[model samples]
Target: MHNVHVITHPLVQHKLTLMRRKDASTNSFRRLLGELSTLMAYEVTRDMPLQDIEIETPLETMTAKVIDGKKLVLVSILRAGNGFLDGMLNVVPGARVGHIGLYRDPQTLQPVEYYFKMPSGMHERDVIVVDPMLATGNSAAAAVQRIRDMRPRSLKFVCLLAAPEGIATMQQAHPEVPIYTAAIDRELDAHGYILPGLGDAGDRIFGTK
Candidate 1:
């Protein structure tokens, strides 16, 4: 919805299409995901603040605008979230990284956090929580709440695919945090998986399935 940003970039959609095919090899799928994340990073970081600083070029001195790389943090919701790290890091090599590990209880489909770690000075660092799928939204919501506890300068959620149910759940839980996704799929399946999703993102990325 209003809080969600669906990236329609041609390269993003093209790679996403390739990834959705059932026959795509694990290697191909993983590679495409990395490439897609790199492209998506552009949109997600579009509004990052920049400051002007003086720099000397070979021929002249000039004022250049640049972001505070040290003040940007990428928080990955473990496993599948890890898949997003490499690509995003490729673009923001100086950005700090954090992790939040959560697993869904099969029966309840609720998130249970088993690990959480973040860089110091969260209150002054902008954070982007990366997870490949926003399916049930429980894990993401829980992770965001934990980050909120630290009072980060700003917070956002990023995923390759999102289900409408998940988006609604997040909106209800934390309307202040915006969500960025390549696609908002139709809905979640009976088992809480996003329909038309590229299967379990962790499995696909790690060749676990």
Candidate 2:
């Protein structure tokens, strides 16, 4: 847990519990994820640098703090990661967006990237990569390495859930990048799914199954 931060707010826990229910409707699950991501966004961006600027208020002129420079970027790790975009965007409306598409090979349980796209000047911008689950860590680590190549000012990984195996994989691969998650579940099953998790996030969010 050296570089990991878990959000334990009561509301976050409550919403997560609702999302885990087996009978939760796709619409309800997606809505809960959106709400939960909005809440989690507050914590992930807590350390954003701020600068003081003088502004005239209706009552008086005073210096106020605002985030420095351009807003941060939210990089979605393909299909499931997109589920976190709206909620995070709700809180940081000015944030730029990027996408990386990777699918787990059923036989090998490894990530194979099919697409990668990002904004310009990544070296000048902070980045937060979003994914619903970090079950295997291969995709997350791969995505992080690709982003690091762009040399962003700073970087963080945000996920709805994580597993101990996946966490260890990330720790070994990219120990410097901090990870933010709502929960770290028990462990991953043989097929690389979080135990007691909400099931396939992409399937749940998109009704693909």
Candidate 3:
């Protein structure tokens, strides 16, 4: 569990409860997701390196802390991840954005990558893979593997919610990378959905269903 950080912020918990209600509207769902992602981003970037630099202020020259080295690359895992991208970008406005498109095959329970395009200088940047729910974890695991192939300087997974099974699966597959989430649910349902989870994130955020 060293790599996993479960955020217990009141705002995150409150919005998550709102998101769980069956009657939550698409607009509300989308707005809550943005707010939650912004909070999660704070925890996600807590350990980001910082360096001190001398700067001239209105009064006099003083040392100031700034983000160190490589700028971050926010990699959204397709449609659902896009919801989180906006909020995270609001916090780290200068972070580069990337996309990885994947869909689960209903028959095989496998993730199929349809499209993936990342910033060219991945090796020089820290990457944060965003997805809303880490249920069965097949999609997030696959996405991480694909991103790893690019040899980024560092990589991490960020999600709004996760299931224990999915966390286990992810740890087994990529233990080196840390995972950050607002909550870790009890388990996955028979159909591989997180129990008591806020329905399909993409559908909820986009009103697709």
Per-candidate TM equals 0.98, 0.98, 0.96
Model 3 stretches astray by more than 4 angstroms: 68-70
RMSDs, each prediction? 0.7, 1.0, 1.3
> How do the residues 69-133 of candidate 1 rate in per-residue lDDT, one tens digit apiece?
89999999998998899899888899999999999999999999999989999999999999999
Q: Stretches of candidate 2 above 4 Å error?
A: none
Error of 2 at 96 (Å): 0.6
Give per-residue lDDT, candidate 1, residue 97. Answer: 98
On a 0 to 100 scale, what is the lDDT of residue 1 in model 2? Answer: 82
Evaluated with TM-score, which candidate comes out highest? 1
* Residue 189 displacement (Å), model 3: 1.9
Ranking by lDDT: 2, 1, 3
lDDT (0-100) at residue 13 of candidate 2?
A: 95
Of models 1 and 3, which has the larger lDDT? Answer: 1
Instruction: Name the lDDT value of residue 17 in candidate 3.
Output: 97
